[model samples]
Target: MDFVHRKLEPPDLQDCAPQGTKVTDTDPRMIYHGEMIPVGTPDVAQGLKDARRALRTNRFRPTGRRKSMIIDGCAGKTTLLLQIGRAYQGLLETERRPDSEWTPVVYINVPPRRESNLDWSLPFADFFGMDHTINIDKRTYRSTDMTEPVAHAMRESRTSLILIDGIDRIHDSELTTAFDYFDCLQDRLRVSVIYCGRGAIDIVNEGLHNRRRSDRPGASEQFRSSLPVMWIRPIPFQKGQEEGWRTVLQSYDDNLRLYNHQPGALLELDEELHERTRGYMDTLDQLICQTAQQAIEDETEAITKEALDDMRVGRNEPDDDWA
Candidate 1:
């Protein structure tokens, strides 16, 4: 038997955006909403591949170690996580029968709290469509933990993987404890896990080492040795990649009603915008969306350099000291 080789195409940007959206100066949803274009930088592509591989491998054979993906803020870290979840869910939808009870992946945004042991397990219970309850008693032997049900539900559901976001939200004092909690979950559940965050990986490693030395003698070595760290760098539109930027802008215009501008028209200003925003995707999106909103307010169909400059005015202050 002969098999045909076929190439896959990128998804339509309109499909990625909200249905029939309109933008105004007062309404920034078009710019800030969850709509995302997968730029597919090499780093992001590899990160997704590694995550899928780990999940696939762990599903059949248990892997007690978790995976870590470190992506800096504003570099499309959330987008990467969403894409991974979507892809895994799509696979589940296709491969599993309608009545099957397997949940291949679960994505959770770690809450902003010092202690998140219960917060972490709640999402797991919710994802498994199970009820969780805690029972307490004054007697020392009668206390009941809520996470037991969540863990049982996860195992019953055949949950193979978990994607955690916002690992950086753990308070400094509780960071080590949080890592220990996650490590315990991995060991107990035997599920593949991936964490996305800014700068928590190094701290997590250090915390693991401290725990191994002071508390659990075998804690850090296994985790630190087996877990692989993947970094996703910022994607910038470089020279010869004008077409990529054009597709992105065209997607924005088609979805957000920005200036009713054609892709070619947007491409004409690419160089100027690139120079201004340094091709940072978030900044570029903000610049174009805000500039187009300004142009619309001025009753103009075209976005000029003046509009770009005016939109950027008073917004030049650095939001952070780090790039």
Candidate 2:
């Protein structure tokens, strides 16, 4: 999975068809809808810049302010993290020796909370493809605490960065142990960690505050002091942000595979798109991609305002005005 992930790149406009050209291939056109469109929004651009600097400064440092980053937002957090990861992996491929087994970056989602004692190292073990369980007998097996072995694997692989998504899903009670595991990884492995999720700042700050109160030394003082956070919010429709928002729409417009879409069709609906999606990037994507698919199904082969209006997949219900 790591190998496949490293090989995967964000979908490109060339993956489908040139603008104003017909996209008759059913599979490719449909596949484009599910692809994460890599619009170079300011937030994403800034994230890449920060991630590069963190990876560079944290290199070979044994301790002190590893410069970890937390990307916090209600939306686009995971997408931005994945984008950074892909870019990081691409750069690693060029520097790595052909014989090296190093997997410089590890990306994993925070696993769901468990009823029993959660082995916080499980996600890392899974990422490294290590067995986290030991066979006690022919028909019996026990879960092995893989904290040491997973760290060993990371050391062997020479992993420099770890990208963790879905930090918000961890229950408050589980934060200490999970973060303790992470703290250990950073301190022992000397790896820079980047985390992503909604409300991540409050969640992590509260965890650190609780740890401080309890006098646990696991949450490193460096992490508490030097962790930099970048918030990724939806582009607002207000003045001064109009160009950015329209540029995003222009990117989508430029990539649409619809046969009859005009060059500036989506750009013209920037305001209406914002109104429909309330500036949520994911919802805006859903509106355009789903409407494009609907157009293809109905043989229109082009997105129209009427088709967009018929789609009701926003995160919130439409207001009475839109309804």
**Predicted structure with the largest lDDT when compared to the true one:** 2
lDDT of 2 by residue, 1-323 (tens): 24424432434446655554544536566666655355677788888898887777777565684767888875788877887777777777788663346777889888775323336778778887787777776788767677787888889888878898988887767777777777778888888788788767656666555543234434333345336887687887787768878888888888776667789999888767888888788888888878887776666878777887888976654453655
Give the clashing pairs for model 1.
none
CA shift at 157, candidate 1, in angstroms?
A: 2.1
Using Cα atoms with residue i matched to residue i, what is each candidate's TM-score against the true structure?
0.67, 0.83
Instruction: Write one digit per residue (lDDT tens) for candidate 1, span 101-141.
Output: 55556777776543656655666655565555544574343
Q: Model 2 off-target regions past 4 Å? A: 1-26, 60-65, 98-100, 114-118, 136-141, 211-226, 316-323
Worst 10 residues of 2 by lDDT: 212-221
lDDT computed for candidate 1: 0.58
Tell me, by TM-score, which candidate is best: 2
